[model samples]
Target: MNKYATCPISTNRINERVARLNGLFTFLLIMLFIITRLWYIPAFLAFDFLMRSINLSKFSPLAYLSKGIVKLLQLKKKFINAGPKIFAARIGLLVSSAIFIFSLIGFNITAIVLASVLALFSFLETAFGFCVACEMYPYLNRFLNRLQ
Candidate 1:
């Protein structure tokens, strides 16, 4: 058993890491087409993995990582209250990665332009701790409440 596994991730620190990684992976998923057709499997598997990883930092991140396969097999809908919103920027990352890869292969005429834009955004996020994806959760939740 690794260290990060057994620990219960109820703390704010764990939550923060989960949010950040979720954001990063979501970014990876957006570019699935070029990354590989099978990327969805990894993407969804990653979803399950993150859902389980909610407790990772408490115990062992490695142990939580190993369970992705099991979680995928069980397949449940433990939806995140604003998970998708918290991870919105990740979608942007994936989209940008796809375009970046595409641009490398000379597909879209504006691949360079698109890549540059996304890269710039990513840089800002990394450098200044500006997370566009996570910032919308409160507003999104409010909007959802209004819908109710």
Candidate 2:
């Protein structure tokens, strides 16, 4: 993490605000996605923007999309520097987002229940700083790397 990265949040360790926001966003986004609601899309979209305003989501999908849209367009200098908290948010959202899309075929009750549980976890990060996905990422990466 750069010393001068936005978010006024100093620390590779995820900050309290980032955790709470990520948790709330994940829980709500997943809940919204399950109901086949269009409202979730804008809500989700707004999340990255909010994070960006606070300097949380740095080089996320939108940033990637912008750069992809115009190769010559220079991304903001701070755009590419992803902090740990934002990274956790990115990964959690990625997983929950997939679950949301998968629920479209039908209301998979099991999936809904599982997702709700995950949402609660995001909520818990506010108090416990528990990032289940981040904790798993390393082992999963090692296992996948070994397989390859």
The whole-model lDDT of each prediction reads 0.42, 0.51
Estimate, for each residue in 1-148, the C-alpha lDDT of model 1 and write its tens digit.
2322322222232233333444344334434432443434333534443433343322433224423533555643333333433254344535455664555566654554554454444444445545554554456556676999
Q: How close is candidate 1 to the true structure, as a TM-score?
A: 0.34
Residue ranges of candidate 1 with Cα displaced over 4 Å: 1-11, 14-33, 57-127
lDDT of 2 at 144: 71
lDDT, candidate 1, equals 0.42
In candidate 2, position 67 carries an lDDT of 38
How high is the lDDT of residue 114 in model 2? 56
Q: Alpha-carbon error at 127 in model 1, in Å?
A: 4.7
Pick out the ten consecutive residues of candidate 1 with the lowest summed lDDT: 4-13
lDDT of 2 by residue, 7-87 (tens): 323344423443454456555666675575444453454455455435544544453444343445533222222354554
Candidate 2 structure, TM-score to reference: 0.52
